[model samples]
Target: MKLSKKSMTVLSFTLGACLFVSTAFADTLLGSGYDRLKDSAKNTATLMEKDLKNYTVEALYSLKDNDQTLLQASTFAKMDTVNQLSEENTVTKTAKGETTSSYSYSDKKLSVRKSGMDNTYYVTEYPADVNRKGPAEFSNPFKENGAAEIEKIVDAVVGSLKDYVQVEEGTDGGKVYSGSLSEAQVPAVVNAVSSFGIKQMLHDERDLPKIESDIFVKKVVGTAVENKAGYLENVTGDITLSGKDKNGVQHDLSLNVIVKLSEVGNTKIAMPDLTSAKVEKVSYSGGFSSKYVGTYKNDIIMDKDGKFEKIGERTVVITSVEGDKVTGKYSETVYPGFESEYPNKDAFNFEYNPATSSTFTYTDAKGEQKNGTIHPNSAGKVYFEMNIEVIDKNSWKSSSLKPYYDGEFRRIFE
Candidate 1:
């Protein structure tokens, strides 16, 4: 397994599935004990999938070198999938006694962030009709795979290091699994962590520990527990590294992590009261191109006789932009059947990612996500277009594709 990608579920020290273990430990030695543990993991994953919504996750990370504590950091987070709300608070202290912290909260309409440096809270208000994302999903502390990530890694590590890892009964009728890694077996793990894990976890890459070519991993041990609901509730790991630098200077490094999940499906996001807090409220375009924040309409259609029967109008309204996402509405009202395909005044969002050819993901009136783009033509004229091949293949509302809607869109309002 590519440990860097998969084992990132938890701390570098807690992740051992990345290590290639040659010993085939006895699965029969513990008989049903092993099967029971495996069953617990499976059940826990199911529980997370079915009932995992609002929850709180706490992860504590500490790095030390011999008598010197290099870094201590903690991250506490709550997520409410139903309301599409989440909040995370992180605090980090360095060896020099310098501390930095930040808290960020996001709901359906607003994204608020507070920093410790100047006690400033930056608030970005989204546009009207913005809809929430998901209802019930659990992800990593960084919102990756969810706390269940630790469960999967633990199961894999235990399976590989059957000889080294042991399992016992947990207090709440859950299970406790522990394992150890020797120095020779931990270099790959530690190196991957230094090269990838630390960078991914720490908000500032400069805080990463300085390690030279010469390396040593003295010890690495971790424990994982399943809660009463069979969910992977907590994980703790400790790692020690001792080695000589190029100049033969002895250095000892230590890393520790404690990760816990609680209040599954009941955790609520307490939106910080900004009434008395230092806040900076600003109204800014929230998309790849703020200039797209306007209404664009195609020319009125003319019949063959050059006389307007029922004018065909295709209008695209980009109402608001915030952080690479734009909320707006699009409608095609072609004559003969002037009833329009999309509903009026309904808002949808598109992730404005210009790197991929300035493409965006916009959901149609039918609630299907489609690729769309809003850009300036060679004439510096902004135009909007969407690929409805999926909509066409599935069920197109129009009698046929209207070319005007896909053609030039002239800005009519801002």
Candidate 2:
């Protein structure tokens, strides 16, 4: 009998009857069992038919060129059994960064292109010649496994649709529709429709330029069961883009997503200490000095009792002192070469001795070494002597030497 494709229930029962009869004689004593098996098969087929009619599937497809570059793409379609048999279907393609293209199908053939490119086109034929190799018995769509076969048709449509449209956006912001399908089918339907609308907008080229957006978690609140408080947790950030169409319009085109995050579940507070402060002092030291020299008319110049007259004295003073050291400036003037044939008649040397409380030494500039003790004066300041040496007579070349000029001193605390 020629069968109607819409009456899958009747066809499934007929097939089940044939199977039961073929197995009836082998289980003559179990005739009821065979009958039960037939009933079960019929029920399963009925449920499948119901499912096929009610199920709405949405899918996205991307079309690419032979070089694997994207050419055009479409948003997901909401397909069901009612519209499954038409040789032609309507699909929307939203190109990345451009306009959207709406297509019309017919005669088991699909064609789509930019709006004005009508005379020239790209096409795909259905019942694809390569897939038609089955036997005559399997050719009848109704006599075959209806629900499973229908699913294959849905898959093929989704696959073809991909070759034309591209997804420009994806989001988890909408409500989730979940539960026993029979109990929550209404909400599920609403969710499916809303999602399909989003997909449509994404696929439409005119909507491309309006697709950029940013999302962030605004605030967080926590509850505590005991006498304590809960702290805010790590927050995350996101950025998204809607794809474009051929006209450079962004549609359902979504690309470039970024998520920002921070460390989670850490809560501690820090405080400062205020009870351990104290006062302290620090000292530092430094200083500078000056000095001069004079020469005798003769080394043995007579005094009151034929004693040698002392004609010169040299001195130095610490100009400044700071911690353990003293700094001073000094200068010396002298007659050069008094007793020798060096050049000038004013040459001489000066020296000092702490044990004798006087500055005295030899007169030869190149032969004598002068030494002196540095002592503090009554004002709690320190001073030392500088020695002068005369090396020439005619031109009177003299050199000034300050004893312990750049020297360091230390204080011993008993």
For TM-score, the strongest prediction is 1
- Evaluated against the true structure, the overall lDDT of model 1 is 0.55
Distance (Å) between predicted and true CA of 188, model 1?
Answer: 9.8
- Clashes (N, CA, C under 3 Å) per candidate: 4, 60
Give the C-alpha miss distance for residue 196 in model 1, angstroms: 11
Q: Model 1 over residues 125-162: C-alpha lDDT tens digits?
A: 76664432332344223222333665454456445444
| RMSD of candidates 1 onward, in order | 16.9, 48.8
Quote model 2's TM-score.
Answer: 0.16
lDDT of 2 by residue, 1-414 (tens): 111111223222222222222222231332243323323334433432433332221223332222232333333222123323211122434334444344322222222221222332323333343221111011222334344564343333233222221111113321111111111221222233223333333221221232223211111111111101111111111112123333454333222111111121121111112134221111111111221111111121212222333323222433443333343333323334322322222233323322223223433345555433343311223334224332212111112322112222222222
lDDT of 1 at 127: 63
Give the top-scoring candidate (lDDT).
1
Which ranges in model 1 have alpha carbons more than 4 Å from their true place?
A: 1-14, 18-29, 32-50, 128-160, 181-214, 283-414
**lDDT of candidate 2 at residue 401, scale 0 to 100:** 27
